[model samples]
Target: MNITDLMWKNATAYGYTFTRTPPDAACAARVTLLEWLDAGRINPAVARVFPLEQAAEAQRHLIEDRPFGRVLLTLAR
Candidate 1:
């Protein structure tokens, strides 16, 4: 079966090529990620968040590339 025949409802799940963001492009692309994810337009590789108090632990995991994706820092109030 041809993917294009699905009429794009499976667009986010298949039939596209994604590139690794270069350092120069990463900063500009960050906001776009949130926009797309929130709109359910793309299925990200991973999504994780940590509260402000656990920021240090989150940084450690990120530096080790353990949780290798966007880590949202959440606030508690």
Candidate 2:
């Protein structure tokens, strides 16, 4: 899908909050990554998501479990 469509879909599906920060190195990198995602050039692997309050547990899981993919932390809405 195109960048506009991908961004709209993700914003609606994931409750994304778009920001209008000034351009910098990080912003450029983020834009590039979003473009790559929009183009389906890369697939992110997620191991598991832990609630924000369970950060210690998540860290333990990372150290002990050694998961093959990323361990994410999500905020409660």
TM-score of every model? 0.43, 0.57
- Pairing residues by index, what is the TM-score of model 1? 0.43
Runs in model 1 lying further than 4 Å from the true structure: 1-35
lDDT of 1 by residue, 2-30 (tens): 56866666544433223665766776676
Pick the TM-score winner.
2
> Model 2: per-residue lDDT, tens digit, 2-55?
569878777543433336555585578789889998999977888999999999
Candidate 2 deviant stretches above 4 angstroms: 1-26, 38-40
| Model 2 lowest lDDT segment of ten | 12-21
List lDDT for all candidates, in order. Answer: 0.72, 0.82
lDDT of 1: 0.72
